[model samples]
Target: MTSASSAGPRRVVVVRHAETVDNAARIWQGHKDTELSERGRAQVQAAAPHLAAYAPSLIVSSDLRRAAATAEAIAGLTGLEVRLDPRLREVHVGEWQGLHADEVRERYPEVVAALDRGEDAPRGVTGETMAQVAHRAGTALREISDELEAGETAVVVAHGVSARVAVSDLVGLDQDVSDAVFRGLGNCHWIELVEAGKSYSEATRWRISGWNLGPWNV
Candidate 1:
């Protein structure tokens, strides 16, 4: 609600990549280079056309294959090239990368408890905090926002956590409280945000017009 003018608000459609095998097994995929599961491909097939209908001027994605695959699906329909950016990668969960949720809980109860208590704790003992993830992911999002021409939309395909955290950061939510506000984006689901005029602070410069949209929930 920050921008009053019609022309200044840029449309950014942030899509989470489809599910991966690791995701199906509830394993942490942080920085893991995993391809989309079969269902993920089906999800992309279902959602890509809807995203392409936005006629985005740019299609950017995390370098991870799952995100890249989703971006490519939309790109194929729009004739736009997918731009890979490592900065848009998922939060790195360190040694917890290959572990399932229960395994993590059993191995790192304190860390899990800290997070359960809403602390911005480091993941997997040596991994990055949500704030750290927000820094890099938010920077990438802002850059994408700046790259769009007036009234042009851009589609960014990213991992679930990265997409949520980046959007939360841009909209001025603290890492500690963001989780309470935003759940992980469903596979191939998307959030649509409109840029407020530059008059607002960075924390409030983005306004979410739609969130968690997809064939399943739209």
Candidate 2:
């Protein structure tokens, strides 16, 4: 991620949704809308105190259940209302949505190739392209930035891919940088960003801000 100049204390905390059954099964989980596992619940609770410290002025979440549940906890802790935006949902993986990565390679080679190319196209099944998903997320982020410009500290609860891509755009990371960092979206992970003069800036510049330790149980 590249750095930019900023003038205010406007902060944007982007987080990945907590763990879910898909994660436990090693499935793709994109657009599958799975609920969080029991351990996932604990992870959310564990993040509460840390998030509360931020005392966010606004909280935005993906419309998906897993992300919503995670964001709900942050909202409860920070005493902020969480707003749901469907556009912030994870990229649809079509036929690969609920399949394990191996399964995708074994059963849907063509789709797998599409995924590798990072090209937005319809896979074996109906799914939105990477470009489509990225565009939606980028738009959502701009909305969040606009909110920040109006003087609000925001926390955005979203999926890993969407978050990664959005962060890539914000930091102007090239495909290689984005792909390397986006090997996978860390569950309940975070990246801190602040606004500068006319654009948003990243605090760490190129790294994600937080990590998840398996439901916070370990």
Candidate 3:
């Protein structure tokens, strides 16, 4: 349980990958390596300039195509290299992958309800638990932060659920209460985090200075 205050850069900007075909169709992607849709590309393009204004010291992204593409757009704008990390990938949904939202709702209402309540939803065979995803995401973020200098900002481009979980973990929101504390980020939307204190035992040592800042608004 490494805390955000224990070891890391002082700041981070986390962004959700642009939309994909699966996103528009309400289908589960779950590490399926889907590409960005045309609209997704445009969304990335729209966001690049706004993100570049941050002058991120590093740009990190999930290895999945959609996230990679989004990171690439920002990299091109900022002239920073994109570092791909598989650990930042979305939660593996296993049996739920490729299923429509309605299908999942009808087939796994209880699991869906659990997710809505920020509880550990049952991962079907071969899938990952939310706790598993959060652990990996937190570890990856810590590693990236460790490589950064204090006050330097790193932009992390990842999937929606993974980004939310990472932010929740960084802010020390309990897993069972995370849903009440955070909301899903829209495509190309981002949140900003800043270091507030130095105690690993205190979750309040980190602060979310910004939430869900969309490119259109910028």
Candidate 4:
């Protein structure tokens, strides 16, 4: 999209939730709610201060507990109430939920093969596509951006996949391009984006100010 003037928030921070019990155990957690691990609580404590340094006015997050917990940490630090939204949740894996990664690889080798070949395969045969994920996640992000004033900032806490997909949408990059360019979103890590356009649309754009920042380097 074109880089015009910002009509909404000036800056935005996209954060991935910290480690969950499922995440630690390599379980496939798409739309399957799980609690944060002990390490995740500590991670939240560590990352919250860095996020608070931005002085963001709002904190939005997925309704899932994993993301909610992370958002709560920032809220505690910044005194901003957490806004829960289901749109920010992770991609639905259909039957893949509760299954381990290895199980998925074994049971859905065809779908996994397609995805591994860079094809946009539907997750778990009956789940949403990457495009669908981008659509819902992008819409949520746009709404959040629209709610802010020019000088305001907001933190969006979501899952790893949705976070990157939303960035690709806002930055006008192809999903495949972002899929290849962006690496892992480590637990409690975040990316900062500066709004460079008025409103969120095909003629608007955002600049990535920082990426993959965590407590140590934040």
Candidate 5:
């Protein structure tokens, strides 16, 4: 297993896309193609310099508008082509796609219960399962790690849920640690991953190479 500590500076930077208007409204933006809010754009502006510090060789993000826009900004800063990868899309919430937490609890308590059951709940409205999201995200991550050619660093911009899940899979995190990875990452926050030997490791292994250089509170 390649340890990050032994890999020098070859790293992966996991970044949460900038916030959207829906985030400000507390609405579920899963799979929504909402544009970045003005604040979201500014957040990305603030974060660009920090991200450019990586001098990333490649930048990938969800094809959805919010994520795509965020990726575009970083691409501009680093001059790396922004590649839209569908596997990095946000987990589809189906019926709960646009609903707030209170609305979900009030109208679909059963669906929420299913979500808490440690499995992907069926799309009460039209959603994909967490299991499905994990499958695609895990595959994409592995491909980036094992297939990256000539690049010393690659950056992936993703959503909240899948970001935690992907990192959990990479680091073999226990459930609690995996679940709480979100605590350290905020909107437009950057987490650095160091690959040791051929094995993978989490951002905790590195210094705050870059951080929540955004205006939003995550």
Candidate 6:
């Protein structure tokens, strides 16, 4: 585990997209580009004031509709344009994309069990490995952090699984052990990562200052 230190960026708030219809149905929506549900829109709207209090200088989002919509809500509040990045998208679930959680559990009990036990399991035959998602998203976040001047902040709206993986990597957890330390973010929830140093080199250190913050938390 990385030690908590006051060294990194002023703050990097990474948010999970708001709820969607798939979420309401407990369906696996990885990379499926579902739009926000009515509750999702409300969640985003409710979170806007708290997010605005963070005073983020920039907003970045996955190009997927759910994430994009959430980012747009915050952007509307902050008057910041959202920069879209497909690399910030969710993990692709391949054959399991539209399956409900119970259905997946029944069909792939062992795989689901492994995941519940904090072990890595395949999402599907052609889906991305967690390590791959972590690498790409982590790299993107590093680039974003590298560009920020001191005391600047940015909000990154992404999906639950990818956000957890990226944050685990950012804090120096290896992929194998990442799950033990990082848990999934709830819809419209966010985590704040603070840099442990001013530099953004490969060896940069970070500490999670906040986790799973949302309107409810406020």
- How many backbone clashes are present in model 4? 4
Cα lDDT tens digits, model 5, 93-189, are 8777778868878999777777677555665557776567777886786677654443378888888776666665665554354554447467788
Cα distance off (Å), candidate 2, residue 155? 0.3
In candidate 6, stretches whose alpha carbon ends up further than 4 angstroms from where it belongs are 1-9, 113-119, 197-204
Ranking 2 against 3 by TM-score, winner: 3
Give the range where candidate 1 is weakest over 10 consecutive residues by summed lDDT: 1-10
Q: Is 4 or 6 the stronger prediction by lDDT?
A: 4
**Model 6, TM vs. native:** 0.87
Question: Which portions of model 3 miss their true places by more than 4 Å?
Answer: 1-9, 113-118, 198-204
Q: Write the per-residue lDDT of candidate 4 for residues 142-181, one digit (tens) a residue.
A: 8887776766889999999999898778767899977788
- List the pairs of residues colliding in candidate 6: 7-195, 7-196, 7-197, 8-195, 8-196, 8-197, 9-195
lDDT pick, better of 1 and 5: 1
Indicate the worst ten consecutive residues by lDDT in candidate 4.
1-10
Question: Positional deviation of 125 in candidate 5, in angstroms?
Answer: 5.8
- Note each model's CA RMSD in angstroms: 3.1, 4.8, 4.0, 3.6, 4.4, 4.2
Worst 10 residues of 6 by lDDT: 1-10
lDDT of each: 0.87, 0.73, 0.83, 0.87, 0.71, 0.83
The residue-by-residue lDDT of candidate 3 on 1-218, one tens digit each, is: 22443345377888999999999999998988887888998998889888888889999999999999999999998889999999899999988999998998899887778777766755645689989999999788777766666557899999887888888887777766766666778999998887665445454355788888887654
Candidate 5 local distance difference test against the native: 0.71
Q: Which ten residues in a row have the lowest lDDT in candidate 3?
A: 1-10
Report the alpha-carbon TM-score of model 1 versus the true structure.
0.91
Candidate 4, residue 119: CA error in Å?
1.7
Kindly give the stretch of ten consecutive residues in candidate 2 with the minimal lDDT sum. Answer: 206-215
